[model samples]
Target: MFSNLSMGALGLTADLPTAIDLAAKHGFGGVDPDLGYLSGLGGTSAVSEFASSVSEKGLRWGMAGLPINVTAPGTEFAQQLAELPAKLEVLNAAGVTAVGTWVRPMHDELPYRRNWALHASRLSLIAELLADSGIRLGLEYIGPKTFWSTERFPFIHSLGEALELIVEVGAPNIGLILDSYHWYTAGESADDLEGLSDADIVSADINDARDDRERDEQQDLDRRLPGATGVIDLDGFMSALRAAGYDGPVKVEPFMKSLAEQPVDDVLADVSARLAKAIG
Candidate 1:
């Protein structure tokens, strides 16, 4: 997989043009441009220019955040769903091949079965739209036990459950955003990843958990740079991706306050170094 820069995930506030420039400057092969921002640029001419600029910089579009809000109720969800095609059309012109969003692992009202159905129904529709544009959609499962355990109903918190949801959706464009942090928190092994083919993964995230927290107690937002403390098995994780022949974007998503607070260039350089060190 290639190194991709995700500005929001890295806690940077760079706009699309600046992000593209920074990504290339920082040695990232790809950049996750904001879909909403891209949409705002308007029309075919603007999008073509932007795409050309990225290509000229030797960078490609990585997975963007899925613009549709899957959890909004009835009419709201319908409105977002209806507007997706237009947004996707813009993304298509920009040469974006993939988009992804996370699945909330728990629900206060809906139980497992109902929640699963809701997600499947909504995601299936979204996936169909993405499929029409030759784009893939990746669904990320939150794995930290602490995030889901205290809720009234736990939904998908593991790779197995995520696969089940994908199966239910049964859309060819549906895949996974395989993440090192979640894989570790869910107590999954490299063997689990062995079962997946490259196409099964749309994108990936590489990060480390805090050493002080037990696996089950780790918070979702609290993370370290890959290999920072050797608390996560990053080597094994990268090995699995290589073995699976995953050639998609593999981004660093270390949600660390210190890193976020640093200058944009410092954050980019640090992540580039850590990612190279972890995956090399």
Candidate 2:
């Protein structure tokens, strides 16, 4: 498995290549450039340069960030769907093998009660676009504010629902972005991660949670680190991955405010240590 870093760690201070270098130097094998990073590099030319730069650093360029709203209905549906081609083109130009979106099932739909149909439709459309460009699309399961099962944000309550969406979309280029925080926040047990493979897991996010669905702001502060500081079952999750034959990156995507103020070396060291314990 590779050690990966999401550009969200650096916020707005660093540039694309700088992030990649940081990750590589810190022993991360891959880098996921946030959408803002791509936007800053301009268009096609920038994407090509980014791909080249990441490869030069011996890091796999993974596309991270959510830009498409798969839960939209009707006109807004067409709007997000229309944007897929350009997004896929951006990934293609950037040499990004996979595109990850965190808000696919969370927002972007109208009166979205029938979330199943909304998600499946958009996934199919976007999957086709990404397939044309040989880029895989990943659906990241995360919460917007409240945890899953309580609200209709981020992702749904059922792991089966997310899995079914992927199966129904039925594209080899389409897959799941499994996340530890989302798993706990959504109330899914570690046993739920059975039967998956490296191919099914296109991307993954790691963050731990310590509390229940209390207040939105409070939950945000508690979720960070790995399975160590939270109520999450990390050992069981690692066992599940082994059962499913997954060998991929364990991306540190904690949104905790504490890590934001820490120095890059210290922050990376902490995250790297947690990843080592989890993935070792």
Candidate 3:
């Protein structure tokens, strides 16, 4: 496992201090910052200050999630290309190691194989752009309304398909970002987790899945906390990670009202405890 497992930005209200505090308290080695939250802290100028805070707290530098649409057509494409260099500079200033993003062609617009290729080629460009900065690019398998290269069709999803594409790009700076919820939503079994390579494992998220049926919002399987009564075979999943040789950083990623409402410390304490039991 990554000696530096970190919390996503939901913990700190984007406050570097709270993030620093919680991470230190919980033995977390780093944090995966949501850039939107970071902007709310003090905008781009705060990067240096934030980096200093992290260093003081003794946290390894992690990624600042970047917002870019690599597959957008026309001038929008130019916009992403133009803005990325500046964004990368900001991330580098913050001592970030990876740049994670979401990109998938609209399902109706591109054939799966072709979309996969184009996306891969574009990632190669991003890899080249960040080559000297030591920042890498990662693509997450998105939920509905986005295009994806998945093993289960019509049910479409998975970073599994992107693995080969990253190899084709052949840049050390490109890889995949993944979450258990997405893998479950795509109907991927624990067996699917066996194929990851460390170079391809830049980002990781944790969540649980239950029935999709609309409930009093209490049973909304799509956004439950880990250990919440659900059916995400985490033991099997972790086994697959070990099988895949992915001893990388992991993040506790509960994304619902209950978990999100709790104080950061309380939430993380719960996550850290559950993760201990889950991983064991």
Candidate 4:
């Protein structure tokens, strides 16, 4: 397992090279490159340079965000899909092996079942696209009941439900980007993950919650750093992942605004230390 720091919570808004340097300096094995930065640098040639820089710092490219929306309308979605092949080529060149995204409900007017089917169909096609590029697609499910209540139609909000959707999608390259905050809010325990295999989990996000707040009341922006709060059992969560054979990077994704208040280097150091202790 390794640590990743591309999430907005870390407040590290430096350029890609600076971010990778900070990640290595702070003892993280890898860093997720900002896709926008990558694009600004130019295409395949720039990606090659970025990969070389990462290797020089003894770090690996962990993950990158997808630029296109696969669930958009027919023509828009097709255009997005068309753009994916080139993106995959860039990722492959950069040595990034995973693409991460959340499964959000897009149409408020649609029924839940209809939305689910639509998601499955689109994700299945996406899985195929990633498969061709030899990259895995890490799909995240938003697990907060509050989030569901705010949505027009309910969607997959638990690991079990996400896993079922992955099965329905029927793509070997499709898997969950499990988040501890989501897991806790979903009211799921470590034991609930016992049946999952390593392949079922493409990546993971590790963050704690405020003990004083109720699970449903805790918002995404209110998360605490891993092991900094006692609400989520970090040790148990790691143990469960180990038991399930997950060996991917476990990223810190706390959305605390306080992190942004601190110096970026200080925040990175603190988060890295906390994650090391939690994963140990």
Compare the candidates by TM-score and give the number of the best one.
1
Which segments of candidate 3 are over 4 A away from where they belong?
2-12, 34-49, 143-156, 211-221
Q: Model 2, range 1-280, lDDT digits (tens) per residue? A: 6678775742425666787778888877787766556766788897887688778888886556546665444788788777767766776778777777654444333334456666777778777877888877877655434543344434554457667778887888877788776676566777788778888888776776655544333353356578656567878877777677777667776666766677887777777677777777
- Looking at candidate 1, the ten consecutive residues that score lowest on lDDT are 271-280
Candidate no. 3 TM-score: 0.77
TM-score of each: 0.97, 0.82, 0.77, 0.94
lDDT winner: 1
Which candidate do you rate higher for TM-score, 1 or 3?
1
At residue 76, what lDDT does model 4 achieve?
94
Full-model lDDT for every candidate: 0.89, 0.68, 0.64, 0.81
Ranking by TM-score: 1, 4, 2, 3
Model 2 quality (TM-score): 0.82
TM-score of 4: 0.94
- Candidate 3 collision pairs: none
**What tens digits encode model 1's per-residue C-alpha lDDT throughout 1-280?**
6888898887778788898889889898889978777778768679878899889999988898888778888999999999989888898889889999999999999999999999999998899889999999999999999898878999899999999999989998899999999999999989999878888999999999999999998999999888888888888999999898888888988887777577889889988877777557
By summed lDDT, which 10 consecutive residues of candidate 4 come out lowest?
4-13
TM-score (C-alpha, index-matched) for candidate 1: 0.97
Error of 2 at 46 (Å): 5.4
